[model samples]
Target: MSTTVLHARTLPGDAEQRWPARLWGVLAVLCLVVFLDGLDGSMISIALPSVGHDLGMGTASLQWIVNGYYLGYGGLLLLGGRAADMLGRRRVFLIALGVFAAASLLSSVAASGSLLIATRFVKGVAAAFTAPASLSLLTTTFPEGAQRNGALSVFSLFGALGYSLGLVLGGVLDGFGWRYVFLMPVPLALLALVVGWKLISRDRRPRPGRRDHADRGRRRVR
Candidate 1:
């Protein structure tokens, strides 16, 4: 007599699945980063008049404060993605996030309009790196299919919410001081950095077998 045996094959993303709590943590951390990006972008609009008044900046000079940030963000966005691919995603994200926080702190205490605009540009450059890295981390962390779709929906929601809240918060915080708008994100970013360090998975190094295979393929092509 002969016996037949059957083994089930796992789906593509099955092996990458994490516990629900950990998945939420990853999503939250990424969401927070996106939130900060949106917040910083919109928050200053409400505070701009106050900033101009305080710094005695003209309209033309005040415009640069906003324009400088967008210039840095739009210019380097593609480079940020390439960086994440070459370096580890988490490493790039965390480092950029730190830079964003530091820039935010400096912006709050800037002695001149030029210094403030410079810091805002730095913040935007940092954000360019962080925005892509956060998305890369999110896609890699969550497997494709329903899980990834749901996580993405939530991730996008935080961005819109952050912008909305920033508008309101900008008005409220500006009442206290224009500086508060810049200062608010510093603590939140630091918190995300600390928590992300623990929750986000480390990047996988290339296997020796795969490296050798790739090398052999390249040699054949050449």
Candidate 2:
């Protein structure tokens, strides 16, 4: 698959920034990761009424579909945030991306309303982990104020676009079937998964600049 190519090209990271070209590619990939979270929320809203009709659900039952995602996402975000801190951000991010993608796949094919709701909860919980871990990666990567700000601007832009596009996407996809709304995220998720595994640095933290410190100390001594 195309993912195999992505992995082969992305590994053996240039921590020295030897290839600025590759660095940009890596940045774009990470930005794409956070975009998915926003898109999912907006996209599902557009499809919900149709989903309710197709699945034969009442108002109370339909509410649970959205509520379930929020419950899992909101309830466990604190725990997920702590885990991202204690565990490696890269580790949590990759695992969460995998879980989200798997849950989405399962959700798209679910035979019943109950199964769909359960999978949505799983997706939401995974999002909590991925979001914080991704932001951590971004901040760590571009530690300087200017660079970090630029990266954040790009990241936020993607998130905003994802939300705006989701409504249009949901309406289009819903015309075919509500299931396509679940399916919509698959390609984006898979690409992020591949790039996350390959492009995201395993060594995400920066080392202290002992050389600069030494220089300052020498000047002081003189």
TM-score of each: 0.87, 0.81
| Residue 41 in model 2: lDDT | 79
lDDT of 1 at 129: 99
Summarize candidate 1's per-residue lDDT along 114-145 as a digit string, tens digits.
Answer: 99999999999999999999999999988788
lDDT of 2: 0.83
Each model's total of backbone clashes: 0, 0
Best by lDDT: 1
Give a tens-digit lDDT track for model 2, residues 1-222: 999988776764534334376557767877787788888877888888987888887778777878888888788888887888788888898899999999999889987789989999999999889888888888877766666788789999998998899899989999999999998788889888897788778854655599989999999999
**What TM-score does candidate 2 reach?**
0.81
- Clashes by residue pair, model 2: none
On TM-score, the candidate that comes out on top is 1
Query: What C-alpha RMSD separates each model from the true structure?
Result: 6.5, 11.1
